[model samples]
Target: MSDTEAHPVRISSHPAQLQALEPVLKKVRTRVGDIPALLALAEDIGHAAPKPGEGSTAKLWELLASVTAVDVAAGRALEPHLDAVAILAQAGVEESKPGAWGVFAAEGPGLKLEAKRQADGNVVLNGSKPWCSLASRLDGAVITAYTEDNGRAAFAVNLNDPGVSCETPLWTSRGLREIPSGTVHFDQVPATPVGGAAWYFERPGFAWGGMGVAACWLGGTVAVARDFRTALAKAAENGREPDQIALAHLGEVDRIIASVTAYLAQTAEWIDAGSSADSSNAWSEALRVRATVAAAVERVQTVVTQNLGPAPLAFNEAYGKRMADLSLYVRQHHGMRDDAQLGALALKGDRRW
Candidate 1:
């Protein structure tokens, strides 16, 4: 079959299972037209907007299990949740800066809460997670922090508290200038711990967390590729070949995207097997995926800027926004720079997952 005939990637149609996710997948394509919107969405949601079928390690796994058949049928069965602890950690800290939970790292630990113990001895949270997509928008989060054991524990934070505050302003990226990637602050926030230290590192969810982040990165890269193709097609219609450099850049993007997709698929299959839950497998795979995705996003920026030139930068609002958004989004993952070290460790099988 021809390239067009063989590579027909379409959203899954299991409405009851995916919970209206077809539109979300389409929205991701539309919203991530370039880097700016990508960054804005990253800043707004902390990660790519959680698609209907995706999960947050613990709460969403049951949902994932229920929909695994749909995922399998749709060719999305291997995309598992990353580690629960790590996802919670990254969600609360790494994904974006300038949003509500963005300030957690800067604040350090040992903060107090506002609400009393719950009926089940759980505490209600009362702080605003400034840029949280679902929680900040709704009013709370499943939060985590360092315990007396010097390990992280998880909890839920409520945004509706009188002390919870959010500044819903957009970041000043020329491309994705409309997303509400603002700051949220909390005072005397109340929270209850869900899982203890084991949840942070030794749990089963870490491998899944590693996979999930990679999946988001892969989606963003594809969006940029789509934008580039649209531009190239337009250029061809105007009696012009795409600049030679642009074509070369597209080639690079294709290479990285293909390699990462294959690797993620392999990792997902391993996880689904249930016996390959080694820490080394999880960490190394996660690191490699993030590194590849980050590189793909960077390549898109370089190619887009060089091919489209200053005209798009100045005249094309959509393109410019995506460019800017991507520039910022690629940097959100913590320890991404050490991806090489993680890869080395994975190759040696010497590190924990």
Candidate 2:
């Protein structure tokens, strides 16, 4: 591939879906660190779905995966914003005004970030929230907070609000470091209620959006697989016949990729058909797909690293970054606990096949 053509990631099954994304990727490449350009690219790509049952939602997930394979850190930063916006829209929180959005709703005691109701019936958010991505950059956010009357509720806060203060970017990990995920301190920040209490998590789109993250993992894993492929290719090009051991390893990797892909396609069909709107099916499938995809991704990474050795790590900066970013991003999966919960639910629900 030519230098200009080489960077494009048509590495996945959805080549048609990636056509619209190529320009977006190219724009991001030249104008690196330009947030506005990235947002514009998103807008041009159009909303994931203009209406609840509309648009190419599956393709959107594929696009996210492809981008992540190219640059997992950037892909990680972008998916949360897009996914949150989609969920908020489903819950009837329309952004009449224009700006970027996010969700800060990692719930629990000691998680702080409480919402208060004043006598005037206005909501003011106060406290610290964790895992807030693009904390300093997002224009608005869909926040979950504890309120006296409603207990836990979802609220939409404008980041530009005077009362909102985000901590300095403090993520020190080499992986996903481009993502400025940190603490967001809400100090009496006024916000508009997004949906009735619990609506954010209740919306079916929430699970669908979660699947999209797995797609990004798939993309990142493909990127790692390519590293191994390239190592083999370089050997062949240098007049060395490929060893049977490496050839067999490649074949095994291919089989796993094909298996994961078939599962992704099946899940995408379910989501597009709106089966995900069914809570039982959505939750079960979400857990299943996440565990499956996460496992395949990690396996690809492990196999490639074990065989390729440290040359990619020591010599190739982009390859090293992708490896690190994917390593962190795939951790979003919950492993055996996820599978256990899914199996229990499947048994209780009598989900056949």
Among all candidates shown, the one with the greatest TM-score: 2
Q: Which candidate's lDDT is highest?
A: 2
Judge candidate 2 against the unseen true structure and give its global Cα lDDT, from 0 to 1: 0.73
Q: What are the Cα lDDT values of the candidates?
A: 0.47, 0.73
Backbone clashes under 3 angstroms, per model: 32, 0
Give candidate 2's total backbone clashes.
0
TM-score of decoy 2: 0.90
Per-residue CA lDDT of model 1 for 232-286, tens digit only, reads: 8888999999777778877877776667656655555555565346665566656
Which pairs in model 2 have colliding backbones? none
lDDT of 2 by residue, 1-353 (tens): 42222444432345565577676666656544456666555554446433323445656666776667667865675676677677666767777445667777775457687787789998898988988877787788778888776577788888888888888875688886667677788888988887787666677666776788887888787777777887788788999867887888888888887788778777776676767777667767778778988988888887888888898888988778888888888887878888889889877874756
